[model samples]
Target: MLLAIDCGNTNTVFSIWDGTRFLATWRTSTEHQRTADQYYVWLSTLMEFLGIKAEITDVIVSSTVPRVVFNLRVLADRYFNTRAMVVGKPDCELPVDVRVDLGTNVGPDRLVNTVAGFDLYGGDLIVVDFGTATTFDVVAADGAYEGGVIAPGVNLSLEALHQAAAALPHVDITKPQRVVGTNTVACMQSGIFWGYVGLVREICARIKAERDRPMRIISTGGLAPLFQQAEDLFDDWREDLTMHGLTVIHRYNTHKDFRQ
Candidate 1:
């Protein structure tokens, strides 16, 4: 079994992969100070409740927050008896190429998403991930990550709006009843929902124009489905794209001949 950890800014997810398919997945708030013992206890409790008896032999991690990697590494080493393969580290060989400017350190999550997107959907793709920050990652025909854009996430934008204005209250993102909202909450929701729809449409259009090729757009992360429901913003919505990528990278590293 493989323990794949995806550590984002807001959350950390653990997925159990038993070679052929994923057995179970668990998510928790990201905390850098969590210890190995704490992690094992929490994980053990969850597995026990779910009745999933998985012996995590191999571990792969993709962490956006660098601070949490240490505890995760310790968890794999001390508890699982294997060194965790951390993405962006030299030791963890990526199956695909990352084409970016000189000295530009690409985010590990973006790299993982690129690999997963290429493996699942093939090349000439754009993966729009709605994480702490909404990111657009362009993938070349041969699965090379050619840099893309980044923008404020929906939740981040909402938080900022509330913090900046005294009158504005913090609100959740949802599809507005109409383009024009009748109330304060509805108005905020309208701006966020419709604004993102336009943003996605425009960004994808410009990216396609710049690339001058037929490309498919893939949306991932928690908020993807919500946005997709409002409009055809993405060709596909993959909730487990990052987790799937970790499994693919693990396989590639373990077996040299492993292909997408």
Candidate 2:
């Protein structure tokens, strides 16, 4: 079985993938302070509960937080006896060309999304990921990763508003019943929800205008379904897009036939 770990700013997801299918998946908070031993204990306990005893022969990781990579590497080596293929490292092989400025450190998660997007749907495309920061990544028709936009995520924006203002409290983001909110909570919800809809549409429009071609938009992340329902912008929403991409990259790297 292959272990695929995707570490985001807020959370880290671990999944076991057999050659043909995903067996079990787990999610945990991404903490840089944790040690390899600690990770092993937690993972083993989870496996015990689930009755999963598959041996992990290979591992692939896509981490947004670089600090967490060290711990993840330690976990792979100490417990699994494998050196994980950490994306964004010089040694990690990618399936797509990244067309960006020199010395630009593109996040591994974004690149993985691009690779998966290209593999699933070929063409001029934009991936809107609702992560810690809502990112817009452009994938060219030939699968080259073009530069893109990054804007404040809804939760970040809401937190900033609440932190800066004494009267405002941190809001639980949800789908608003109406755009014209009457209560303070309702008003905040409207702004956070509908506001993102407008932001996504405007950026997508600009990208389409600049590219001057038909565009396909894909949405991913935990909050994708929430916003995707508010607007008709996203062509597809795959919650496990990152896992799909990681699996592809792993096969490409480990299998000589795939690499060729």
TM-score of each: 0.98, 0.97
Across 112-196, the per-residue lDDT of candidate 2 in tens digits comes to 9998888888858999999889999999998889989999987899999899999888898999999998998999999999999
Backbone clash pairs in model 2 (N, Cα, C under 3 Å; residues 3+ apart or in different chains), count:
0
Give the least accurate 10-residue stretch of model 2, judged by summed lDDT. Answer: 251-260
lDDT value for model 1 = 0.94
lDDT of 1 by residue, 187-231 (tens): 998988889889989999999999999999999999999999878
**What ranges in model 2 sit over 4 Å off?**
none
